[model samples]
Target: MSNHSSSTISAFGYEIIRDHILSSVLGKHENEVLYWAGKELARKFPCRTIEELVAFFVDASWGMLELIKETKDGRTFQLTNDPALMQIGYRSFRLEAGFIAEQIQQIMGYLTECYDEKREKQQLITFTVKWDVKERIQNTIPNE
Candidate 1:
């Protein structure tokens, strides 16, 4: 057994590691990117408010939203495998803009993991979509 201590994790250390991982591996910050991404997707997917967004999460059986708080600039939502770990086990998201579409747009990523936790062996799923919503719709004009 290793003697490394997990108790001394500083807020700054967590921020540093989290920021690095999100920006490098995930291509987004947990808040600035992942959180907002979920929010955006939720908007696109058609949930009215944060509560509905959370309910959609529950419907998908993606843990339960233990805590959800937002501001004009962004939002923070958390889900957990164990309801007791609302403090530790929950995952979060954040974004700059306030709109239903933001949450809807980013929600697919969260949904992507819907089948993951129960699998004995997991597989990578690629997420691709219309990054430019307006442009894609504009480009697809049927001409006979």
Candidate 2:
């Protein structure tokens, strides 16, 4: 059987933030350069495996992994609201934890819509986030 689950991007969307990040922080920095900051951010959120790390970021709504690269210096993922990589947000921290991975590409982005939905992970604490855009990226993906 084929596992066909649907998803979408909306309120608590990354539009406002992504735009700010790309314009203000990322600036004219080609997708390649900003990836510089991305690698740093990924490290902050310590994931045991790259797969977990990729899953964490995409599920974490830390923008979308538009692109990922590694030079002689380091590795990075260029995330954005690609629409192609849309997903459902967690209403609580617990729910965000047991979240599963998607079949979509590892790199995706966020959208600007407004709405809410039910949860399959009932034992999880799901909450909408208006995450502060200050700590753009961290050294590891803490258990926060």
Candidate 3:
């Protein structure tokens, strides 16, 4: 998971570890743990802008992340992976959601959260990210 790691893993290999191995080890707490892990990852590899965030997703082999909509209080993103990856059984996107939430929270100085909805027919996931504009965090992480 290191940003500077020279090694690369195939999509199938990534799925094996992420979907099979982690699921077996974490069981019912898989989603929750992955979410926090993703947040920690964001802290380690911070993205200063939406462009950098999208690039990070691609580099991490998470998916192609696109900002579909934006509002004063929130934003909506669409994530799509390789069609072959979609056929590889069940998958959860909570990690990606948490990553986006934490990144936005750090960038905006707000308490942000994100949730994802699977668009099965479209073979994509939609992430809705929201923040309390009225309740700002006292200490926001500065971009490095």
Candidate 4:
């Protein structure tokens, strides 16, 4: 199969697992479990830079991730999917948020967390990744 076709099939499978299977299996703790799972995934596939992080999301078929803003303590990112793909009812973005949090923590060497805000009307998600500069970790990803 062509790469594009393979990606489409992968994305379809991802939706099935993410929207239906995971929720059914995880039940009420679905979000929490997925959040931690994302963190674990990040550790396994670490990204050293924001560019790599953005590319990782696309390569993983998660979504189109764009860094929309940055501040002293945090960064804001927007995640959007194709309009046709937005029909899926799964509203949870916790997994993506957790992944971003962990990636940022490793990259910045600070205690970091991410919160996701769903804009259903806009069919997009906004992630606010915040870090405490004071809470630095010793082993950080070196800049490339």
Best by TM-score: 3
Model 3, runs deviating above 4 Å: 1-8, 86-89, 142-144
Determine which window of 10 residues in candidate 3 has minimal summed lDDT.
83-92
User: TM-score for all predictions?
Assistant: 0.31, 0.33, 0.89, 0.87
The reply for model 1, stretches above 4 Å from the true place, is 1-24, 49-51, 66-80, 83-144
Model 1 deviation from the true structure expressed as Cα RMSD, one decimal place: 14.8
Error of 2 at 78 (Å): 12
Candidate 4 positional error at 28, Å: 0.9
* Clash count, candidate 4: 0
Candidate 3's TM-score? 0.89
Ranking by TM-score: 3, 4, 2, 1
Error of 4 at 73 (Å): 0.7
Put down candidate 4 lDDT per residue, 1-144, tens digits, no spaces. 567636454556666777788889999998899889988889888998999999998887777999999999999999998755544356578889999999999988899999998888888889999999999977766433
Q: How much is 5 displaced in model 2, in angstroms?
A: 19
Deviating ranges (above 4 Å) for candidate 4: 1-7, 10-12, 84-89, 142-144
Per-residue lDDT over 15-63 for candidate 1, one digit per residue giving the tens place of the 0 to 100 score: 5554455557665344455545654554455654557766765554344
Go through the candidates in order and give each one's C-alpha lDDT: 0.37, 0.34, 0.86, 0.84
- What is the Cα-based lDDT of residue 137 in candidate 4? 78
Worst-scoring 10-residue span by lDDT in model 2: 105-114
